[model samples]
Target: MSNTKDIPFSPPWQISDLGKPDEPKVTELAAGPAVARFAKMPIVIAEDDLVSRTLMNSLMEKWGFKAVVTKDGHEAMAALRAEQGPALTILDWMMPEMDGLQVCRRIRESGKMVYVIMLTSLGAKENIVEGLHAGADDYLIKPFDKNELLARIQVGLRILELHAALSARVKELEKAVGQIDDLKLRIPL
Candidate 1:
């Protein structure tokens, strides 16, 4: 398979169209009050341990995200494919049916703009490298700091915003190029 991209833009239907923005819901936070609301990104957290799952799910909500708690990789994949499934995903390394590494690889192969974050107990350098090579956008040790997790999530959100911007630009460029081609064809040359 060639690495070259003729038109690497996302499918028209899949493009993140920011048109007709959703009505903003005003919510008060402990830190402050009143601000414009943006679309809450769907965060898929695949964790088998009940305690951990509940903790992470609540944390994600506290950090302003819609969390889909899945007990296995299959469930995680299903959530990722859903219409409401946004690009950010958090996968626990150990899960039944399939492991996080496998899920990450599959997500990468599918090329759906999904960001896979592997949260595992393994802290070895080799393990970290392996997870990243297997398509994990980020990897966190099991006993992660809540603040750190939120920081990482913010970084991912910024990257996703950039992706949507680029995708929109691609569509605009395609239209402009098409118009130029049509004009060229109209002229006698």
Candidate 2:
């Protein structure tokens, strides 16, 4: 039997597995998303509930994404600051010390463009709008399905790719404009 233990970390659904004797473990950093496949963009997971956190991390690996897992908003913020690359984030709506909304707002103010997805059990329309206004790109309800979450992540990946392309194009245009200006300066009036 797979030995996963329950922990009494606040918010109830917390779990921790000691180890499965015959299984190989997945680490916090994986090559799937951060290597040749997902453009080296790490996905940040900030969930308070241990069970949910563990499940999300597992799914991320299976979905071919590298993850930086954080216990709460504070840790998530630290991870965001330290990641130093384009990254997508999954934030839990309710967490101790700092909630997801607070984290989302701070991320928006940082001026770094990252796709944020709010993971919550709250399915109300107003709640979703609140999350969006806080700067979340999308929202996923709890007990999420494997395939659906993967598809949603795929959408985020696509958007991130598009953003990167646009940024590159802008740089090229700026360089060309600079060259043109230099040539104009050399022309006789």
**Model 2 Cα lDDT, one tens digit per residue, 35-92:** 2346235789999999988998887776545688999999999988887646789999
What's the CA error at residue 75 for candidate 1, in Å?
A: 0.1
**Lowest-scoring 10 consecutive residues by lDDT in candidate 2?**
7-16
lDDT of 2 at 31: 24
1-189, model 1: which lDDT tens digit per residue?
Answer: 888445444432232432223433223232111111222557788998999999998786665556789998999888888834337888888888799999999899887887778899989999999999999989999899877776677667667766766787788789999999999999978
**Ten-residue stretch with the least lDDT total in model 1:** 30-39
Off by over 4 Å in 2: 1-36
Which prediction has the highest lDDT against the true structure? 2
TM-score for every candidate vs. truth?
0.79, 0.79
**Can you tell me which runs of candidate 1 are displaced by over 4 Å?**
1-39
